[model samples]
Target: MITGGTTVNGTGVFCACYIRQSRKKANKSEASPEDQRDKTKGYSDNEGHHFVDFYEDIGKSGYDPDAERKGFDRMMNDARAGRINMIVVHYASRFSRQNVNIVLMQVLELFQLGVRIVSVNEGEFTSNNVMDLMNIIMRFEAGHNESRNKSIAVRGTFEKARERGGWLGGLAPFGFEAYKAFVDGVEIQLLRPRKDESKVIKWCWETIKRHKDDTIKQGQRHPGSLAGLVHQMHVDKVPTRGARVGGAWKDALWEVTTLNRILRDPRIAGYMAEPYGNGKKAAYRIQRNADGTPKKYGYDPILEPAEWWELQAWLDSRGRGRGLTRGESLLSALRNPEDEPVLNCACDKSMCAYYGGGTSPSPLYRCNFRNVPGHNGNNTMVQHHLDEYVARRIFARISTAEEDGDTAGFLLEATKRFARTQEAPSNARERAQLVTERHEAAQHLKECEEDYKSVKDKGPATRRAVLEEMDAAETRLKTLDDALKALAAADAPALPIQQWINSEEGNGDPMGEGSWWATATLASKRRFVTLFVDRIVVYKSAMRGNRWVQYDASKRVSITFAGEGETEEASEAA
Candidate 1:
């Protein structure tokens, strides 16, 4: 029997036995999930605790938070709601191997709720004992350290494998197959070209290379766009590689993203590389040898490097950086209801927004899908007057002092009332950390740039080294910037209206919320439009002459507000 004030002669105490296995492959050990479950059950039975439920997470990492683990989430919810008096895990690590902050927060919450935690191997954790709490934290730290060490080891092993030209074990790209080979009496995974699939890949490359110049000349017919080469391939019934499961393949359709990957992949040029980072910060380039040339692998080259690079250049030139951005006048929010995105062209393609070529230079949205078969009709719209009309309606919807002064005051009061109800120190710390890290990254990035600029008459090798360092610093700064943005998104607390407006630093206005809607940045207004407006549908009037004219009152457009689904119609004045 436990000596703490809490009762442990558990006749009525509900015990939630939790078990976790980090991998599908099981080792034959006493701590194995099955053995752990049996031991926990037996212990609960011996202690006379009422076994209410078992939460088992198989093939799930211990370090993942509750949101990622279904069983663990349900168990925590039950404990929080007082549905269970105690939680029993095979060991402390099974509860959590996360970093101290995350693990301690969950444990402290349970302790505060008068819930007991027990480990089958280590015994119960009594809330009143500081030593028990420290021991629990120490055990969790051990687990966390083990996980970190294992991760480092895995990365090192992978790096060595990369050096050896061995496959790092992921889904093979379209035209390749992962196969096992014995090299130096050790079995290693290697990628070899798939015969039937390789032919399709070669054709895609050849066709793309042949059309590269044409694509550059007329950006709309480019292979990078959906309605361009991808659509053409779909029409021609070109067989693309499919997903493989259990040594079986299923038919998959071609997509521009996948096709772009094939075109950009250096592996098709008989090289192997590894991806680093995630999202827009990700980098993938040719792996290099000691002599500074690309490392060659066993796979056969499907396309020449020169043609592959040319195709890549064409694709890069057509990207968003080279074109008219969304901030341009008159092209905002225009939509075609039949498109997959509904905001693009009817052919489910991006429309090139530009000023008209002739004297007037009015804003126009031109769909490049004219080159696509069955989509040869002109998909153009004049947007000169549409911009002002949309702006008027959107401005009306924005919370202004004139429209909802009372509601804004009420919201302020409500937020103040609820301000003290939930204060997350962890969130505050995380935000502060992000802010500090962002500043440091910016400072370091500036220093790197200065260093690069200051270097004079340097050797090619020295200059290259400095450039690489600058590039690394820039990449790190970008990563930190992304993280800060993400943190801000997650921590948008409902502060008072005045506080919300003044959150933007360096503003002189003491009470800016009154005029915030008007003075808001274009990016902010764009976000507001996205939130409040569902879609803007544009239509053309019957042409008086053979050629279509600029915007006039006859050209109809409708702005549909989001929640209420109310649509307001407007037209350009003749």
Candidate 2:
């Protein structure tokens, strides 16, 4: 059980703080996020308890602290490892508001296990006191009260912004900037156009419509109504409202967020939020699952139905049956004759047969799902002709750009290359060593637990030995696991990487090195391309003598082929 004291008699009491601020900071100011964080650091110093880490979700709205997964994960990790003997925060809501009962249970348990909590702005929570219990309850109540205040403040901000023009706390469209109204008024938005970006944006919608019209004329397929209107912002990639970093353009995909910003603005659409904020009706998500899953399509439609439909029609058209994009083309189907083998079939378990001229005509790699009987996926016979393509396309450019100054082509190619790679691990070895150490410490936690039982049952200086031994073991184990997991993942196959290198069509000019090609290794190059262009739909027939072959009419094989009809190209001559 926990004891009320200034200090605990334990050496490994891990200390952490959760830092948050309600105000948004777009620039450097005394009241900005950085300043607020510094304040917490100073406060921790004054309290005499050394906090080894902090969870900073500054500028992240306070009403829904649970949405900050990073903060939650760190807090949970602290609890599970028994490292945290204390959780410090400016206020209780700084941790969580919505799930008070659950959050309190977690924090209170940490106190019982010799951990303590202190809200620097609120008060210290000691398990023995009735005051601490009251403080927790009051803090939780304050969190909800604060939420109510924030909603009112937001409504007022929107009301004022709509009437007088200001920046409300909402995101802006892709090609716009949210500026403060007047010199120091509410936030407002201004149209920030890209270099011919507006024209291109509209043209993207037009291009889709044209493609759909052609399909309809061919009687090949029926197109959706909103075929041409592509959303500037969508679910997959909500545009970040800031300057582009590195060489990336546009920041994120055009999505509903972008569209909504455009439609809601009275500045661009010739009205403001003031009218709507004071209006009787309000909009909320129509369909939320009892368990919280949201239905995809949600619209509060400020604009007329006709205008919204036009936008939808534009989007539906662009997504019309796009035959596996150039990047997604398959190897057996790819037509370049100037490549070598890179990918091996999981079917054969090796590249010995398909490569090295064992087969007269190149054989595509087939999955052994059916043949092997128990594989991750069904026995999908996707083919791969990866002898040369991977080397030339995916990893080749990294070589050329590094050796020679071919920056333009390199970036474009690199984007396609990078799209295939997986997101990096949350805790890389170099980072968060404590997290790994704690996890390791946890593995051996059972050992300490046994020793702890021995001290209680067998009775006795032995306490130090048990606790110290368990702590050391757990820390070491975590470090080792972290090191192993940090090793870069083996390059895997991608649908686009294969198609890009294998096809004669899009394999941009020779990988130019001023003197010689040196950036990438033969193995790296091969692995890179094949990983992207994973599966190829192979349509083949038994060949006789390499001169000609009779057509097999029975087998109409179409794995991923999206075109209306298949044609016999000279490249695929049997």
CA lDDT, candidate 1, residue 337: 16
Per-residue lDDT of model 2, residues 1-574, tens digit only: 1222334346744567677665455453224545546665667677665656676665666566445556657666656666566777766777665546666776677767776777767777888888887788778777768786767887886666544444344654433445543535545543333333344344444444454323132222332222123333332233344424323454544444444434333232122222222333421211222222222212222332333334443342232122211222233212111122222233322122122223434433433234342233322222332333333433464434445553444344344345335435542333334433343244346545755876865534577767666666666666666654443223322334333333333334433342112244433443444433333232233233233753332231222111112322223311
Candidate 1: clashing residue pairs, number: 1
Q: Which whole-number lDDT from 0 to 100 does residue 163 have in model 2?
A: 47
RMSD of 2: 24.6
Residue 67's lDDT within candidate 1 is 33
- The estimated TM-scores of all candidates read 0.48, 0.36
TM-score of 2: 0.36
lDDT tens digits, residue span 1-574, model 1: 2222333343478788898888766865226777878988888899887777778888889865543788988878877776777889888998988999888999999998778999988878978999999999999999989988988888887666676788886787767788877776556678887777778767766665565323132234555343466788788887666533423446677787777767767677676766655766554555654323357787667765544554555555455323322434333433221111223443545455655464336556666555453244565665545455565554443435336654454333333223323436776566555654454455456655766776757778877887886677678678877875565445345643353334244453422334554466654444434444555655433343234654353255566554344555544311
